[model samples]
Target chain A: MRNRQKTEKDTPLGAEAAQRRHRAVLVILAAALILCLLLSFTLGRYPVPLRELLGILAAKLGLPVEPFWTRQMELAVWNIRLPRVLLSVLVGASLAAAGAGFQGVFQNPMASPDVLGASAGAGFGAALALLLDLSNSLVTLLAFGMSLLTVALVFLIGRYVKGDRLVGLVLSGIIIGSLCQSATSFIKLVADPTNKLPQITYWLMGSLSGASWRDVRLAVLPMLLGLALLLLSRWQINVLTMGDDEARSLGVNAPRVRARIILCSTLLTASAVSVSGMIGWVGLVIPHMMRRIAGSDYRYLMGASVLGGGIFLLAVDNLSRTVSESGIPIGILTAFIGAPFFIWLITGRVDHYDG
Target chain B: MTVEVEHLAFAYDEKPVLTDVSFTAREGQFLSILGPNGAGKSTLFRCILGLQTKYTGSVRIGGTDTKTLSPREMAGLVAYIPQSSRPTFNYSVFDIVLMGASRKLSPFRAPSREDNERCRWALEKVGISHLAQRCFHRLSGGEQQLVMIARALMQDAPVLMMDEPTANLDYGNQLLVMRQAKALTKEGYTVIQTTHAPEQSYLFSDRILALSGGRIIQDGPPAEVLTGETVETLYGISVRVVSLENDKMRVCMPINII
Candidate 1:
């Protein structure tokens, strides 16, 4: 008889290999994140060596102090670079988590939080705030609110179309994004070109320039809430990647899960946008890097994306400061680095999208 | 556990797909839904699985109304393998099968050792344990189908609903999948499968439900329901149904038609 053998006691290596790879990737990402944070703290116009940076941080924490404490170095490291680095890490983690969640929910690697008009909506809200000269807190609130509202609008429109949710959602996002961009331009056109317009344009280009302890405090609630929600929803995201029908069969209330993920992702995107303006590429590239490194399991993928994104943006922000006499927009630097890397990744792994 | 569907009515927009369809599958019975294309068999499966909420019907599992159960609870009772689904990403065969246990595991929890064992067991049951490490999309169509069935088995649900499980397989693989599905029924799974092959329904199914234009036109043992007249009426083609020694029937198209 042919080996119609149905039973085999042999355990497969796929699961083991996947777990090992995931663990290794997590370790690497954690190490990279720590290294980037340290580098960001150390390297600047006036480069503080690693030892001095550590010494200053330890001294600030009331640890036994190292003898070298210059006021200029103290001011540069603590007052200038620290807040920017912290903000970059927070914003990057937020965008990356949002990207991972969006990709999982939509079952499309191409889907990002910004694809649903969240970023543009936030930009428009920020632009309007600039034109009206709203308070900082109010501007942040308006940006966050409008961002979520835009996603909700896209979701509603997608449902109304009664087709593939990913396609519908993306199409509606494009329409809404254009509308938001036009509104932003109109606001820019109407504002004082010398003052408000330049400020709005610079903000829209995205930076860690104005990042402060206050902005960080304002960002904490939404960022933490969004991350917690994404982490909690990660496993459901596994079933969700199977597409709507299969996910439903696996006992996931598909619409409810999709809505929750979208809400969390939008909140993450909006909060990051509100804090750092419209930094791009971290949301788009970080998740793909995570997926390539850590398999498709969202539990590990989301974690890696969070940490990896944090490190990536922090490094980019550091380069933004050090590369030029006049600091460059962090978003522009991210695009310049991210776009070529993405093209190379895609070209090498064209079969990644086959299934 | 038995599954009962009554007065099922479903529509996409204004056009109806299933209307007043009623059927029942006793515990551990292999029920094959045979129909022509667009005959609403898939719609029926979806309704029973609670995937088609727009349908007006009562679907009961183990005598409990499906509406009373949460999605996870429903999934624990019934597992579904779609006709053909494309994963958007490259997931391992084991990972795909482990998804079947999602209902039993918490959102934050990793698949437990028990879940992993079940996944391995399911893969073995489908005779694809060796393929567990392979990327799902990298597998042949037949292998992918088996992996999906393994996933459904990992659900460990009492009722298994498979839509065209053998549709894309070659002749040998077709028989192989059907044999495995039939074995599932003997293991106490109430299997409901939709297929184009009357031969498969004849050889493996305990009972056959023949659908036509959104209604059950014939329902009985395979030998009784898979008649030449019913086949002709449903498919607009001629077929031959012959009884064998074990009270099993063989269905085949006439030679001239081929």
Candidate 2:
């Protein structure tokens, strides 16, 4: 409210300053993400020295490099560490971008990628695949397919319901999500007690531990496609947040644009979950943080969120590995960071952002 | 441009909300829609804006029926300003105004330099260029309403349709918004607005449209249609239409006011 009345510097210079701040934050976030990716390469259990990590990266860029570490170290950096780091980046960027888009279109700050039941549906898919003893690739494919299908169902139902489009989409998502969750639980109930149940439970908790070059390759295209579509619609997403009637009056085909956004976000989220398991908090928390930093314009919010989310997950994944001998799951660590921040967010600042 | 409505009617769930509604306004004219709740003023606005397609009637703008025109084409002809309220996001006032030019913007591009200048021009027209940096949701109700008017102006359309332009405003702000709307008419734009206050209609409008029971009961100049009997019948309250000596100014004062 204090910022509301102080149009004192309402000059063009002040507006320019605000634009400068947004650009600055975006630049800083992008730089910080690159730094974190390099830093994550050096922080694991058998830590590769920073010099060795740099030399390996420099070698990859086609520059000649004298080896600072042995063949095993090179293998660790290129084979094991790099793929997992890249996976974290893809999953993190995809979720945050989708989450920010979802929040905008739904006009709800609390909205996340799971608002349309993609996560629960994908979780059920993965659990069913595991219970049936399917191959890893088959499990991922099923999960991705199911997530898209779930959202499609919710979207179709929301379309038929005659009410506020945002509310109907969200309501149908919740209902379908609960149903999928129950189906997943039923699979748990009937699974073999020892090997299969633990795998399902651990998978549901989320990790990048099993990440490989294959997963990274498979996830990158869909994530990038979804991200690109979202970035293109950032300006339209701004109009969407104003509500449907206003959007139409401005000559936007509100339903078409809203569906496009929902579709892109769903595909992005489903691809991420198929590779990384049901990672929470990255989607919900990172968008909130980006909005607070850059305000709610989707133009800056989308790019800032991608970088911010990637940096956050890479850092969290590092902490997950270094904090314990066996390494905690990435999902648990995200909660450790996200829950307290959300409490801080909601205690005083929720209502104003709604306005 | 000319706006012509013929035999416009609408219903919801077998209940008629507007029937046989018709009106026409041309360049440099100001029209006010006066009615109580459920009188279908908003529905009529929606039909004209091409938002409500299920209705049966022709809303012709410049000899082209709205039903025949695309939504984009309709936007080029009429700009709509909804009743002002706090928005969900804290978009800068400039960006909010820029959105009004979406009809001219491509889906994959930012606002062009000319669009930005137009937005600034609109801000100046409403005398709020100083608050262009402020969050739209943070402004006062009157300021928000003015920004909405500026947004409508930025659309650069020939006709402006506003829903309750002075709603939820104090007296001074009401006059401020009403005066700006009136000024738009002198610039050769057709301005149509709805208001519950008959006095505001009498004060700001060159013509009045009085609606009751889902129909236009009276439509004419303010001096003819906004009489004490029509005002009383529309709002279900008896009021005296008092005229002042200065330029024949009128005020609708309730008879019960001692």
Best by DockQ: 1
User: Could you give the fnat of all candidates in order?
Assistant: 0.63, 0.48
Residue-level lDDT of model 2, residues A68-132, one tens digit each, is 78899888888999999999988999999999989988888889999999999999999999999
Task: Name the regions of candidate 1 deviating beyond 4 angstroms.
Answer: A1-14, A350-355, B12-14, B242-249, B254-258
RMSD of 2: 2.1
All candidates' lDDT scores?
0.85, 0.87
What's the count of clashing pairs in each model shown? 0, 1
Worst 10-residue lDDT window, candidate 1 chain A = A1-10
The CA lDDT at A232 in model 1 is 81
The candidate that wins on lDDT is: 2
TM-scores for all candidates: the values are 0.94, 0.96
As for candidate 2, its clashing pairs are A355-B88
Poorly placed runs, candidate 2 (over 4 Å): A1-10, A348-355, B256-258
Question: Model 2 reaches what TM-score against the true structure?
Answer: 0.96
